[model samples]
Target: MTSTYDQLVEIVTKLHNPPADLIRPDVTFAQLDVDSLTLVEISLRIEGDLGIRIEDNELEEDLTLAATTQLIDAKLAQ
Candidate 1:
């Protein structure tokens, strides 16, 4: 099974099409030039694809992919 981080990377890639090298765990969405609209879209995709609802306000461009994965994992645990 694909991990949450891998799922998130796929979501971001499908939405933003960022370079593969830049999709590392340490890279923030801001670094990939993801805007507010794209972030909202990403959140929607996450909900649909992962069955986890991430509030729009909870997603910050400063959040790294790893951090987002942790957030989703925490939510799933709940």
Candidate 2:
């Protein structure tokens, strides 16, 4: 089974089409070259695909790839 971390990475890759190496744990949204609108779209995609609700405020500007995976994992655990 795909881990939540890997799944989130895949979602980001699909959304940004970034190079594979750029899609890892330490990466930030800034590195993805995503605009504000894309971030909102990605958030919605994550919520829809993972069946979790992510409020806009929870997705702070400083959020990282690893943190996002953890967020989703926490929501799944709930």
**How does model 1 score by TM-score?**
0.97
Q: Which sections of candidate 1 miss by over 4 Å? A: none
Per-residue lDDT for 1-78 in model 2, tens only? 999988888788788788876777888888778777778878898988999988887775468989988998999999
Q: Write the per-residue lDDT of candidate 1 for residues 1-78, one digit (tens) a residue.
A: 999998999899999999887879999999999999999999999999988899988999999999999999999999
Report per-prediction Cα RMSD to one decimal: 0.6, 1.2
Global Cα lDDT for candidate 1: 0.94
In angstroms, how far off is 9's CA in candidate 1? 0.4
lDDT to native, each model = 0.94, 0.83
